[model samples]
Target: MKSCYLTRPGLLCALGADTDTVAEALFAGQQQGLVLEQGWLAHDHNAAVRVGRVAATLPILPPAWQARASRNNRLLLAAVQQIMQEVERCKQRYPAHRIGVVLGTSTSGVDHAEWALEAHAAQGQLPEGFQFEQIDLGDPARFLADWLELTGPAYCISTACTSGSKALVSARNLVQSGMCDAVITGGVDTLCRLTLNGFTALESTTSELTNPLSLNRAGINIGEGAAVFILSAEPGAVQLLGAGESSDAYHISAPEPEGLGASAAMQAALRDAGLDETSIGYLNLHATATIKNDAMESKAVDRVFPHGVPVSGTKGMTGHALGAAGALEAAFCYLSLTDTQGRLPPHCWDGVADPALPALPLVQVGQQWRPGPRYAMSNSFAFGGNNLSLILGGGA
Candidate 1:
């Protein structure tokens, strides 16, 4: 297979609004962006929940693109703005049709729809600027394609949490298949009422800082942000080495007990990368802090790396970005792979580990890995048992 190089990545989340800011905060194990706030739940205005919200001022979309305007798209625009130089470089080197766009998102403009509905009920008409296309799942990709003027394959993936990582996998295929020479890929999600309330109904949201892999672990904290990358055939600082995907469909909302499906995805990624357990220097786990998820993932990691590998669950800091979680965590691994000091992202959780789970080597603050070609794996298991594992390697 032709190799796909992951060029400069643009990411913004609860950590910060750019790669450097987020990386600095990530290595420092900072959770300053995650704050307690209320008003997300319509039925309960007094309920304050800890959430990973982007505190930075976002760029506004031009009036020409007003129809596509939404917080979800704005977050995506914020990320893309960071990579404009590289994107322009690609435009100079390739035809418009040779550049593709593939993004993953869940709550695309749903918040706008919520507002429109409220206005309609109060005023007997849809909001003056509301458009049905804003709520479409494909809007993010469409907005990006029009913004960049790229005529290649542009689309969105919406398999719950795995959407973002799956976009990377699919973008790699497009490049390797010669469908495009370069593709803008990654994920973006915004805070919205539908998702917050939906997960609340499922009893999957936590009001406190999410405590993943801890005895007191309760549930996840919903977050919003975006991570965009330029994926090309040209070699770059980081490379997308391999990817594995599987859909076990074990449950609609819960992962398979014992992690049979999760293990399959991880093992497949290793096989795809032509590496074994010891080759991975670090792992960014899909630790949502939910009871069943943490338990199942523990077994899966233990099964794949019986000898133990350095691992960390980062949801405590970024909250879960839902469809963007996979890509956001993958971006964390990308940042780790490129760190000159070999600083591994610390697991942002209370110092407590559940004794019942396997004794995985969770990374601590100031943790550093050995010098050499660094390889890391990021896991994303979504609803309905959709799972994906991505292997990224940097250095010689």
Candidate 2:
């Protein structure tokens, strides 16, 4: 497959409002971004959990997209705003029908609906200006397509945690197959009571700061954010070299215990990039901090990179962004390539290794980054055994 360039990228999360700020905090291992507060979800009126909430004020939606207004849309709009100029240039470079938008999301305005239902429960009527379609998963894509006046293929992907990464794969397919000339591809997800409470019900919500690969690891902290990347055939500083996908369907919530599916995805990614695992300088793990996930992922990492590569799970820095996680981490890798100081994102944990899990090298703060155009990979494993791995060859 021909290399697809990831040109301009925008990001917003608990770490920072934009890519540069987030990258600085991420590689420096700063904890100033991940803050905790009470009442994370509507269902949890009592139990307070730590969450990665965006602290910056959001922009008002355009009157044209007011009908689809929601926090999710706001986050996506924020990401796009950072690169709007480049986006407009691309629109002019290609016909409207030749440009595409493909995004991944988990909670699509579900929070707004939650508020509407509350209003109805008390007032016996829906909110005055409430629109029920805000909960639609495709709303983000539709709004972006409509706003851009793009006539090419536009759609949303909601494949659990792998949604964002798979969207990248889909975008590459569109460009490679001559279906489109340029693509605005990435993902957005907003925090909501449904996701928070749902994970809590499954005993996956941890009360303490998430401890990825720690012996005392509890679970994950739910979060929300957006990451947008302009992908095209034009050469750029970073390239989306390969993506590997697998659906092992081992369990609904739990991954395959033996790490067969997870390892396969990593191996496939390396294969797609035509590189050996040893060539990878840094690895962004899909370590959710859950007992099962860390254990399964550790085994997979051990199998693939036996020589030991610097690895880190960014959930401790930004929390788990769920559907937006894959692309968000990829943006981190993109920054890794652009950073001239050569600093790798450090592993933020308690330094207590899980005795039962396979031991792998974890990147520490102040560690020297890989020199030159290095290779990196980000893992995103979702429910129903949906696992996706993306490989980038640039700065690591």
Residues forming the 10-long window of minimal summed lDDT in candidate 2: 31-40
Question: For candidate 1, what is the lDDT?
Answer: 0.91
**Lowest lDDT 10-mer window, candidate 1?**
365-374
- lDDT by residue for model 2 (32-79), tens: 666677776666576677888888788897676677889998899999
Candidate 1 lDDT over 1-396, as tens digits, reads 888899768999999989999999999999888889988887897899788999989888778888898989999999999999999999999999999999999988898999999899999999888999989999999899999999999999998999999999999999999999999999989888899988998898888889999988989999998999999989898899988888899999999999999999999999999999899999999999999999999999999999999999888889999888888998999888888788998987777889998878899989988665699999999999998999998853
Which parts of model 2 are misplaced by more than 4 Å? 41-44
Candidate 1's TM-score reads 0.98
Residue pairs clashing in model 2 are 337-395
As a whole number from 0 to 100, the lDDT of residue 126 in candidate 1 is 98
* lDDT of model 1 at position 65: 81
